[model samples]
Target: MNRKLWAALFLAGLAAPFLIYPVFVMQLLCFALFACAFNLLIGYTGLLSFGHAAFFGGAAYVTGYLVKNAGLTPELGVIVGTLAAGLMGYIFGILTIRRQGIYFAMITLALAQVIYFIALKAPFTGGEDGLQDVPRGMFLGLVDLGHTYHVAGKPLELNLYYFVFIIFCIGFWIIHRAIHSPFGQILKAIRENEPRAISLGYKVERLKLLAFVISASLAGTAGATKSLVFQLASLTDVSWHTSGEVVLMTLLGGLGTVLGPVVGAFTVVALQAELSAFGSWVTVVIGVTFVVCVLSFRRGFVGEVLEKIRTRPPGQND
Candidate 1:
C-alpha cells in the first residue's frame, strides 16, 4: 500500500514485456486501465454505468478511422477519441444525472445504442468491414512502432505491443492522479452518503458528472489504443457485450482496488482467448464466472485477499 510498493508494481509492468508475450501483456494493460477508469464511477462514486461501450467502441472507431485513412498519428488519434468520449459523457451526464440507479443505467444504455447505430451507419467507420489496416505508425517520429523485437536481435513485425504498453502507462498514471486527489475524496464521501455530502455544501450531482466524464474519457483512451493494437475496429467493439465485459472485469478485479481490474482484465481476456475453440461454451463459461464471482468473491479477487493480509497477525506477508 506504500508508495514504494506501488512503484515496484509499476516497474514490474514496465519490465513485463521482456519476460512475457508483449502483445498479450499489452492487451491486459489496456483492459486493466479501462476497468480502473470504469471503477472510478461505479466503485468509488457508486454509479453503475451500463452504456460504457459508447465511449469504448466509439473512440475505437474514431481512432481507427483517423489512423487508417486520415494519416493521423496514434497519439493524436487517441486524444481526439478521448475528447469525443468526454463530449458524449458531458451530454449524457447532463441528461441523466437527475435520475439514479436503474433510470440512469437505462438512459446510458439507450444513448449508447444510439451511438452504436451511428457507428453502424457511419461511412468513416467502414460499417461491418471496420477501419482495417490501421498503422501503429512511429512514436514521436523516432521509434518505428510498425516493427517489433526478437530473442536473438532481429527486427520482428507488430510493434503494437510496445505502443499499447506506453498508452496503458499514461492512462494508469492519469487515473491514479485523479483517484488520489482531493476531488476523489469528495467523490468517495458522496458514495458513502450522498445526502450528507450535499448537506455539507458539496454539489453531489456535479461530482458525479465529473466522475462520469472522466471515466468516459479514460475508457475512450483504452478503446482507441485497442483499435491500433489489433489494426482494426468494428461493431464488436461498441456492442452491448463489450459493455458487459468491462463490468465483469471491474467486478472480478475488486472495484475499489487499483490492481484488481488489471488482474480481472487479464483473467477474462485470457479465458476468452483460450476458450475460443469451444464456441458456445465460451459464453456459458463467462456467465458462470460472473455468477460465481458475484456470489462468492463479493469483495473481488484482490480486495478480499488484500484485506485478509492487512488484517493478518504480525510477521505475515501476502
Candidate 2:
C-alpha cells in the first residue's frame, strides 16, 4: 500500500458522508473491517473458520444489550463486546485449533450453530425480533452520537460516522501491522506448511489461537460499530448467512490482499443496496457477479491486479 493511496483514502472517507449516505458508508466500513478480520485467519493463517458470525453477531448483541439495557456508553459497550468476542474466540480456538482442513471448518460451523441457537432462544436477545432501539449514546460522555448535521439539506450523522471511521481505521491498522509483523509471518508460515512450522519448534497451536482471538476481537469491533450505526441488533448479524457473506467479500475482493476485503465489501454492499428493488432477485444478481469475478479474476480483484503488476514485463508502462 502506498502512502499516497492511504492519504487519498483518508480524504475520501472524510468526504464520503457529504457525497453519499452516511449510514450506508458507515455500514460499508463496518463490513469491510469484518472481512479484513476474517481474512486474517483464513487468508493469512490458512485457517478456515465457518462460525465467525458467532463473534460478529455475538458482539453486536452484546454491544446493543449493554448500550441499551446496561446504560453503558457506546465506546464502553464496544469494548465489552470486543472482549466478549475475544473470549469466545479463545474458547473456540482451544476446541478446534488442533483440527485441520474441513474438520476445523466443520467444528467451527457446529459451534457457530450453537451460538445461533442461543441467539434465537435467548431471552435477552429479543428472540427473532432482535434487540431493537439500541441507542447510539454519547461518545466519551460527550459528543452525542445521535446528533445529525444538516449539510446541503441532507441529514448526516457526522459524529457517529467519524467515530465509526476512526474505529475502522484503528482496526485496519492493527490488522496491517499484524500482517507485516513477525507474528504474522509465523502465521503465514503455518498457513503454508504447519508441519514445517511445527518442525521448526514454533508453538503453532498457541500462535494460531492468538491469531484467532485477534481476528474475533476485530470482528467484534466491526459488529459493535454496526450495531451503533443501525440502532439495532438482529438475528441476521449472527446467522450462518452473514458468515458466508463475509467469506464471499473476502474472496471476491482478493483473499490475501490487504485492500481486497474493502473492495469486495464495498462491491457486495453497494450491489445489495442498488439491487434492493429486486428483492430476492438481488441474491441471484450478486451470485452471478461473484461467479463472474471468480472466473475472470481467480485471485480476486485485488489479488489479480497485484499479480499482474508482479508478473508484468520489466520496463512495461501502464
Residue 68 miss distance in model 1 (angstroms): 1.7
- lDDT minimum window of 10 residues, candidate 1: 151-160
- Looking at candidate 1, what is the lDDT of residue 149? 66
Number of the predicted model whose TM-score against the real structure is largest: 2
Candidate 1 lDDT tens digits, 4-119: 98789878877777676676776777788789889988888899888999998888888888877788877888899899889888998999987888998888889889988988
Give candidate 2's whole-model lDDT: 0.95
lDDT of 2 by residue, 1-318 (tens): 599999999999999999999999999999999999999998999998999999999999999999999899999999999999999999999999999989999999999999999999988999989999999999999989999989878899999999999999999999999999999999999999999999999999999999999999999999998999999999999999999999999999998899999999999999999999999999999999999988888999999999988988798677
Off by over 4 Å in 1: 153-159, 313-318
Clashing pairs in 1: none
Kindly give the stretch of ten consecutive residues in candidate 2 with the minimal lDDT sum: 309-318
lDDT per prediction?
A: 0.85, 0.95
What ranges in model 2 sit over 4 Å off?
Answer: 313-318
